[model samples]
Target: MSESIRNLLEQVKNGQVSVDTALLKLKTKPIDDLGYAQVDLHRVVRQGVPEVIYGAGKTGEQIVGIISSMKANGQCQILITRLSPDIAVYIQKKYEMTFVESAHIGYIGDIPIQKTKSSIAIITGGTSDYKVAEECAVTAEFYGNKVERVYDVGVAGIHRLLQNLERIMSAKVIVVIAGMEGALASVVGGLVDVPVIAVPTSVGYGTSFGGVAALLSMLNSCASGVTVVNIDNGFGAAYMANMINHIGESK
Candidate 1:
């Protein structure tokens, strides 16, 4: 702004900058011009979050274009969810700051990232369920929450989870990933006091219907504070976990 608006009003009393000059500076706030692929101007300011690019079904060029624009505004730590390995490799070749996760192939920048020590525990029912669980973990980490991953402790081996129950209970939030019968969420809910974010993976066959059965089972859990996100939506689960974990940090 060319004029100091707050100072100008005081100046009116003490005779410094004019009211008209103050008005001119107030009218020149920063605004963003919409691009061909996105109108991602005020995302962080309005929603208390930044724009997240969903990499599935989008071309590499489109991903590059989106990242280019986001970077121009100094908004780093961009996350591209559901990206394939090919696309992730392509993105990595272009931008060297990428982290391609094992659970999901999402790409995240290691720059300008927010940092938080309040932890979120990401657990998987089995090895097959790790992909979605990884997505949740990576997403939470990108959103500036410290993450502790507890992998392959499915309900069939109840002792596996119970062995780590203390670690599980230590988290500010817990994301439980499962597929078969989706019983892990309920099991977790019965164990911890923190919010349980359940994610159902499409890991089984015949009766699984690409994870809908697990999704339903999670949604219908009898546990008191169990909340569920969409099947295979690791990003969504992490976003919720970050939101929950950062509640105190914002204060």
Candidate 2:
């Protein structure tokens, strides 16, 4: 059960709230109907994380409406992915927002402090891949995980990657982002003792086929613990890394 439901049940057991009152609280509608969208209000109850807003196709007004509803319902923090700076600036006028231009992500509130000792390391193969790496770093931090960033450490120069051996090996979960064949994932996977999440970005020449070549390369990685996410799916990789980092924590 969710903490909210557990607390409500405890109140009933202690006679602080009547059974009917408890039942009413439990039976409240699970969605917020905003005409354009029916936001899932009980997602945090079902999963540890709450719903995230995808801002690519959403209008600024629509995003504001959804955020308003969530705030009214007591959600303190909100994450918005694939947001443009123009839209983010418009939204920021109404609410405080931390906008990451490179990652194309926006946060309405401060990230919660990490709850675990295990940390997530985000490594990028090249300078071109920093956008995707930043997305992974911000998402992991938002989910309450300490994140370490190691950038421009692709296979083209083994020395750059080797220099950060201690940071790479000590991380509980590593997110490797690369393009142009995506060999960095396998390289990092070989070095790290923990789980490795590979994110292929569309940051290469014509032969890269907008990250398809990298995607295939990652899928066939020889490293045992290397797992691959979809092309440019930084959020998905970070979410998986966060789950792996908090594996032993009590729900």
- Model 1 steric clash pairs: 103-131
Tens-digit per-residue lDDT, 2-78, candidate 2: 56677778899999999999887667677999999998888776765678999999999999999998888877789
Candidate number of the best TM-score: 2
User: Candidate 2: where are CA atoms >4 Å away?
Assistant: 1-22
Residue 17, candidate 1: Cα error in Å is 16
Q: Which candidate is the best by lDDT?
A: 2
In model 1, which regions exceed 4 Å deviation? Answer: 1-36, 105-108, 111-115
Give me the overall lDDT of model 1: 0.79
Worst 10 residues of 1 by lDDT: 1-10
lDDT of 2 at 13: 93
TM for every model, in the order presented, reads: 0.82, 0.92
In angstroms, how far off is 225's CA in candidate 2? 1.3
